[model samples]
Target chain A: MKTVQNNTIRNGIKVALWEIRKLVWNKAFIISLLLTPVIWGLFMGLPRLFEKIGEPAAAPTTYIYIVDEIGIYESLSQKVSDIDNLFLRKHSGPIDDLRNRIEGDENAGYVHITEEIFETRLISVMTGTGDTHIPLAFNTRLKETLTRYELAMHNVEAGDIEKIVAGYFVSVSPVIEESVDPMDRVRKWVPPIFAMIIFFMVFMSGMTTMQSAISDKRDKMIEILLSSVSASSLMYGKIIGNFFAGLIQLAVYLIYALMFIHFLGIPGLGHIPVHQLLSYIISPELPLLLFFALAGYLLFSSIYAGLGATMEDVMNAGNFQGIIMLLPALSALFISPVIGNPEGIIAQIGSYIPFTASIVMILRITLIDLALIEIVIPVVILLASTMFMAKLAGKIFRTGMLMYGKEADPKEMWKWLRQ
Target chain B: METLLNIRNISKQFGKNTVVDQVSFDVHKGEILGVLGPNGAGKTTVIRSIMDIIRPDSGEIRFNFQDNNNFLSQIGYLPEERGLYRDSRVTDILLYLAQLKEYPRDRARKRVLEYLAKFDLENAGKMKIKELSRGMAQKVQFIGAILHEPAILILDEPFSGLDPVSQDVFSEEIRNLARNGVAVLFSSHQMNLVENLCDRIFMIHKGKKVLYDTLLRIKQDFGSFKCEIMSEENIRDKFINFKETEKIEQEGLRTTIYLKKGVEPGQFIQKLPDNISIEEVTIKRDSLHDIFVRTVTEN
Candidate 1:
């Protein structure tokens, strides 16, 4: 009996390998698998290229036209020169001429130093696209210079001006603090992309599971299979087969993605100062990511196998599979924000759930200082859910594989489960 | 003889229709039991129920083996629907299926090669199932079922879609298995083959067993003694004189007589005149096909 059982398992593996080989060699599977990474690489590369083309060649020299009778121009030039990499070009021209040149040249912008119109003691400043750091820093320096000049006209000491500016700085710290090192900011994106990569691999490999199950039934091969091996064994063998296949593809994508990023000299990639990028890529999270990936792969692939068994053909599996496919993709869409704020209610909630946990947990691990308990809790929960789902899927597979000509409904599945 | 398989009061219903009703039969060791029925006659259903493919509404199937623990592993099944993993190579698929039936890897490999060679499919073993012709694929399916050397073999419609040569090969293989004491139960639409191969037959019609007996016994019990007489005189005028004769029909020069129940061929022969030359005298028991039709229509 033990020998018979061993043969059953060995045969199960053989069946699984046969399934994988067929799928791997199929033209459609090959084309679809290759297409995803190529398209993703192109999309990731395109935007950086466009940004490089449209950026200004060099920073424009800072010029301010002062019309104030208080004579604050000299102090402002000194303040502008204090800022690193900022060159101050003082122009004693009409305000209208300054405005025309600033508007005409694309790289240039202007700041007018005049008495405030809205407030009594403040200065009015204007610039184009205020979002840049250069203009904002320049504006702050000019304000400081004017305030010191106004005080000096009343015989206030220059050292007291420094004291006053220092008094205005507040030491504000983040409320939801994270232990992420400042230099590791680039590492934050890796988890989401890693999650996406895993998701893509699992999804594509799941197509193999579906195809194998459907092909077996469609060709009437399942009857022979069932007569020899139990349906549960066949189902598990298929899921495991695809799981290994998924891991292979994922391994290739990891190598290819890193090489591609390195070859293209992506900014803040491998050459980053924090953890050498390569170390971060090989972080402890990698094994955890693999763990979660296997869990996620088995969970989804088992469901896919069940759906495949229940469906009359591969085409009929689409609507059922669409629901499963949308799950991880949808989780990936929301994973970024969750990573950014792991302590948030949504991330905390999603981390505990199986479908969302793989992406959410990876993202959280990268961006936040998660406790051992925090990490283990979701892993345990996801592992438990995977086991339960696999059991349910096995039952469904056993019942559904034998049924033909009609799709199994949820109620019927529930009934089978009861049995 | 020891009963290898006992199916007791098995019945199957699909929705509102009963497909198999109270069907009971047993397969004894070293015997080939033919299940003969028309289309929708529950023959396949009976086979499936025996395999436990579908749960019967009410039935119990018991198999007796030397070791009870190994009973399930000792049975081989071939469904009417031919099923082989289409993308897999013939040898790999056969070995895989054999393993599922509990054959070890080396043994499975050896058996697979032997069976492929036996079927003249040695070179085709490495070919994909999709690349094989329908008949070749069917042979592969047959090998998958029996590769493990099962004690009991159940095949449904094993002769369908086979060339006469292939059919001969299949029949010879089945005979060898039976000679080796492997109890075989097969269902087929080919009445002639069943008539030749079956020791005993169970005829089903509309979810019920119409007749179950040995071929000789069924013929002896339900058959008519037929005689053809060539006579220039009108046989219709003398037909009433013979109380043993009924429903005699004449066409051209041939006269056919249907012997009534309890009528003996010897008694009928004695009544013939010395001048009347009996061109042919045949005790025609119902052919298996005729029995199948009569059984189905009678019920």
Candidate 2:
């Protein structure tokens, strides 16, 4: 009996080796691996490239039509002559007509400095259609010129006027104590982020497992293969093969991510406490994250493999098959809610549901530290669910692999499961 | 000859349809057993049952070997639906198949090269399956089946789409394998090929075994002498009156007469009426194709 089991395992590994060889040596697979870094580089570099390309060649000049009722235009223009892209033109026409004429002109606008500035100490700048607000350079120059003129009229000293116009120095300091340490925040965030990575990796790898089964059926190699090895072996081999393949792909992405973080100096990443974060991630909590991720992957991938077998063609998949394939996506819906309040009712329920437990538990762990029992219950549930799913998937795979020409209906699958 | 494989009282049903019913057969070493059946006659189902791809409702498939470990490794199957990974190279796919049978990788590699060379596919090894012609692909698939040099070979419609020359090549290879002690179970619609190659024949119709016997014995039982005559005169009645004439068919200027078993052509010719004017005459035994159609239609 042990020998038979050994043979089965050996055969499964042989099948796995074949699958790995096919995927690793495939030209498309290799190209996609290489393309990940190139795509990441493009994603990171495209905006900066566009920014450089978008820099203004030569700023368009704006003509400031000065409607001066007070004799301050000459001095203001002289004071602002150093500013590029700004030209002041004294207008002798009716102010209302000038304003009306330049209303729609993007490059021209008028500023009226009347004696009302002395009474109300207010001056208004009417902009044209092109300008949404008064230009900062022109406004600063006008303020400086008016203050000096007013100081001269009032017999105030130039030093006092300069001090009055000078910008004030103000500093803000928080009075409350720091709530969360930056290191603690990084340490808290690493597990959930790692969980998210594992979840996506499992999703990608599970898809490949499905594709592997579909291709075996589509290419009509399933029977020949089954004659050499059992159908469960074939299904398990695909899951195991794609699992490693997905890890290799994830490793490639990680290398690119590490390069980006190390070189690009992402905000907060540079100031993050790496040693503390690494220690936290390498602890027993890491095993919990891995346990859920692995169990979740096995559960979904087995079902995906069976779903692929029942399909006649990937292009025209049945509605039942499509629904089964979307089973993993249900786990994603619990992400935000569980993260919102880790101790809330939703998180508690989600952590117990087999489909959503892996992700929800990971998110919950990051938000709030849980007791030992909190982790143990979900782990047990996931392990049991995974084992049961694997067995059921084996039955479906055995029958469905031989079912040619048309997709297998749910009723037929139910019959097979019962058998 | 030793019976390397025995299947007894096998039955299979699929939801109100009996695909195979009470089927039993034995495949002996160093011989070819041709499984003859029409469309949807459950030939594939029986073969799949023997391979353990599906379980028969009631049957025992026993392989008489000293040691029964990894019995599947000893069997090689060529399914009716022939396929390989389209994106995989010929050598790679062959090696993978051999490895699946638990054949050593290094030895499988060597066997792959030898088979490729033997099939005239040496130069095409590096090419992907999609790049090969249909015949070439079929040859590659055949080589994949026999790469491990299995003890039992099951080929289902192995020559469905092959050209005549390729068919001859495959036929010769199968004969060579059988001569070297491999038990081969072949299923095909090509009766003439089966008649020429198979030592024994198993015919099934509508999920039941209609006929099963050695080729020579079956011919002796069902295949009697047939006589054809071409004449301008009405000679059908003349041939129909003979005691040895079992049946007669008449066409324009032609007549075919099936003689009863143990009846001699010379005796029948001597018994012909002298008034009949015959332009041409020939006599031969019944062909397997005729017997197949007759048996199926009768059943």
Candidate 3:
């Protein structure tokens, strides 16, 4: 048994080297090796560049054409004046003629206000086109406008409402008493980067694993391979091999990230703090995040290898694969929403699901505090799922390797799984 | 001959359809055994069973597995479909395969180089599998199979795509391997090659064993001998007139006389005309192709 295990591991290493050679030695990956880090460095370095130049108050590019025919324009200006990224311009003409104004600048749209119950509540954003596909960010401006109108209606001084939107007060202990930590504000952005990178690496690498197995079958190399090594060995070799390959790519990206955060001194991107970015990188929870990412990746990749083996043809990749394929994207989608309610029921549910657990748990860890059990539970579940998937993939890959030339029978595939 | 590998009563069924039924054969050291069967006749299934690629539903395929050397590495397999990495260099793929078998790198590389040279694929060692011509690729794939010099070699349709010259090379190498105490179990659609290369032949029809015997014994027991005579005289009537003559055909000056199964060739040839101007008289045993056709169609 020990010898068998040793053989499997040895063969697996060979398999991994084989796969890595195919992937990393390719021209496209070679090009990406050099290009990806530069792109990543510049991307992560942009905020730092902006902070050094210090644009205290830049003029807004998008101006709103505000029309108040009921003689409330001056009063509205005093209360809900020039919102961030949206400056207000008073319009004298009727709202019907605003289409000509919109035709001149698509970004410039007129907001017409009418007196409703004397609250100045009724407003219409008039763009020339019938389908006014306004950006969702405009809703925040509209909500702020309504809030100021309500405050003005109550005759509270406009000067007292400098901070209109919902804001949180963060406390720092030593540096400045009662001052908000800038790190606390940007912490939400940190978790998603981990989640996105994890999800992207896992999902993309998992798909490549499937494509690779299928290519082996197509090339008729699986038979020689099977005769040479056990199916489990082959599976381990492929999974672990490609996993290391993903790590290499990640390592390249990390180097770029380090260079961007620590070295690339772009003055335009001076707003972001390097120390905050470094904190996230060197955070105590980082290891756990990486563990979940790997576990999730294995779970998905095993399923992919199994699917590739059984499907025979790409067209035959059915619902099981479709569901597995959607999982990473779904996990990534959970990232943004979980940032808001990290301790909510949806997040807790996501943390338990092996598919979404990697991103969800990391997001939860980033935003909220949890006991030891919360982290352990999802990781344990993910590890179990990974083993199960690996087993299923082994059986299916073994059976399907020799299935050659015929349409893969779904019934036979089920039998293999059951066996 | 000692049976190096014994397949006893092995049967396989895919769904309700039986693919291999009660199939049995043996491969002995220093012997070349041919497994001849028509298309869809259980040949590949039986070979795969021996390789343990698929488990047989019934019966045991026992190899003389040794602890000192990996038995799997001691067996070289050249599948009919001929699988190799199309994009990989021959040396790299060969090295990886040998490594999987636990072969030492230097020795495996040395053996691979030796075989590549022997098979006239020296330059192809650097080429990708897809870059090689079909014959060259087949040679490279064959070298890959034997680089470790396995004790037992199972080659399925090894000569299917080879030209005559390369076929001769394979035939020579197969005999050379058998002489060097390696067991070879060969399967091919080419009957004459099977007859020329194999010492013993096992035949199947519709997943059932129909004939299993030495090539000489198969000719002696299952078929009649034919006498070919070159004569100006009409020897056809003389042979047809004889009671022992089962089949008689006259073509130009040559006449072929097949004796009845129960009657020996000596019984009919003695009664032929002495004054028939016979120039040459040679007896021909049934070819493997003829026997194969007869057994399959009849069974």
Candidate 4:
């Protein structure tokens, strides 16, 4: 009893240390964990810095020159006050001379108003530079003002004009019974980003697990290990070890993200409506999400462990890792849509899926005011699926760890499982 | 002494090919049983089966433990393919493996350092496995296997990559383990080492045990007979009457003869010329390599 207890404790400690060492020492893990965050911080932080630097520069006031003899200068000046950043400059000359003067001047543009014999009003805009926002804004406002003047001259009422303008408005609100929280827009983007980070952490950590499993098989280290512990114990130890290492990375990233947000003096982070953030952190669905995350890690990692065992070389292990990595990555594409409409059928169905549910369900818990039973149902479903998946993965891992040389086929795996 | 391990008729097959055919072996208290075979002769397969890395299709592996009933803690194995986590320090890996064998942290550390010192690798303990030479890695692997003072030690091709000095050091270690009453089974392709070190050998060819006995007995049973003749009679033709006469070579006035089976050396000498100029007629024994090749090929 003492010896077995001692062995188990020792095995656990060793596994934990091995995992921590690999995470700390591996170049890829270090680069992803340390360098990637720094790089992202620098890249994302540049825009804010540019905005700060340009904030003090005074805006150049807009200047517009008119070349029309239509006597519309008084009406245009009244409309120019309503147009943002437009200032009218009247030039007394023939239209050709006004156009020449306008083209020669670098800071102003000419708007020529004309009337054809058919009694149709014509407007042409001439500018030296096509890229300036002021020229485009001025020309659009001038045209609207002239059209309104022509309508008013035809005895059009002001109420009619309001109606016409209102018809052009596009409403973005969906026809839902419940009022959508404005914060839902921001919340929708958060889940996918969180899922992406988790995906990266799982993938990089899964690679470490793969290396451990394959190195054992290649070097016959598995034999030495098996002589000291059960196959299940070893597999479980490796999974737990890697999970803890992943938690370390997650914690580090969270700390860095918090520091970044704090350093940049971004508002709304400090005032994130404590109730909403707390609801996210302490939701009843959180345990379920964590459970699923653990289960998903084991399920995916078992495939890698099996691959590592079945293959004779490290190079072949990489080929097997693609499937393990792709399953979670493919699930990530649906995270955004699911978060946008978490109460939808697609999101609810995804909440039952082992890979998608962890992110999808957590997102629903945070972004949607779901009923208690609805939340409980998905959590239960995911937990059950996670259990079943873990059982299957464990069986596959045990059987696959002994195989070598050739890749393990489904038939052989089934046979081993049955035995 | 009680039996530590009992491997009863373990048979393993890969598809239709039987790799370990109804092989039965046992390890008792303090015995170093050397398993000798050529490449692909199922030595490694049997070792893996014993370690439970690969399950034998049909076999019963019963372990009779002492006060500690956990069989895993009592067995130490070094596989044919040597490996370590290339990124981990030597001492860390050793301590981890010792821990797997159920050693406590302080004890594991002390034991690992002691083994490192014993192997002349103490200075290299802090370095990673990748930084060590192949010989040094092999030493570390050996330390990993035996650090927990396991009751049964199984080593497959442990000496394959070791230099002469390292091989000697490993030999001494194996001997020391045996002296401390640990059952040790080591597989090797080097028949000379087996001949020199093993108390008893189990020689398998094509997954079947062809010979399992003491080294002296195997040498005696399967050895060839060689005789030198220094006769001036030119009587090579006279020896043709012997039915088992194989090859007779003439060097100047002397003749050396190799006799075939079923012909006794005493009987062949009985027919030789007496009172001749025979300076010496010594019969030489066969080497283990010769015996292995002949036995494997003949079987």
Model 4 in CAPRI terms: which quality?
A: acceptable
Candidate scoring better on DockQ of 1 and 3: 3
Model 2 CA lDDT for position A40: 74
Candidate 1 docking class:
acceptable
Residues B1-299 of candidate 1 have per-residue lDDT tens digits of: 98998889998887679999998989998899898888998988887766655678998888888775545568888888767766778987777677666678898888888999999998998899989999999899888888898889989999999999999999999999998999999889898999889899898888998889888888777766676777666665566668888668888777877778678888887887665555564656557776677667777
Ranking by TM-score: 2, 4, 3, 1
- Which residue ranges in model 3 land beyond 4 Å of their true spot? A36-179, A183-192, A265-279, A312-324, B228-242, B247-257, B271-282
Question: Which predicted model would earn the best lDDT?
Answer: 2
lDDT of 1 by residue, A229-310 (tens): 6677688788778867777667766666666666665564334333355666666667877677767777778778877877
The Cα RMSD across the true interface for model 2 is 0.9
Q: After superposition, which runs of candidate 1 have C-alpha atoms over 4 Å from their true positions? A: A1-11, A24-183, A186-196, A261-265, A270-291, A317-333, A336-341, A348-354, A369-385, A409-419, B9-23, B55-59, B66-72, B205-210, B225-258, B266-282
Minimal lDDT window, size 10, model 2 chain A: A271-280
Spell out the clash pairs found in candidate 4. none
Q: Candidate 4, which segments miss by more than 4 Å at Cα?
A: A1-13, A45-103, A108-200, A218-220, A265-280, A312-325, A329-405, A409-415, B13-18, B38-41, B57-59, B220-282
TM-score of 2: 0.85
- DockQ numbers for every candidate? 0.35, 0.67, 0.48, 0.44
lDDT score for residue A222 of model 3? 83
Q: Number of clashes in every candidate structure?
A: 0, 0, 13, 0
Cα lDDT tens digits, model 3, A1-419, are 78877777877888888899888876888798889777765777688798867866564356567777555566555554434555568888866777676865645677766666246545567664554345445655565656667667678777865564455688556865643665555454565576558667767788888888888888888878877777877777787777777878877886666565566543544445567576766657677777777787888888888777765677766666566557677776776678889888889889988778887887787777788898788878888877887887788888877777764566787888876
Q: Candidates 1 and 2: which is better by DockQ? A: 2
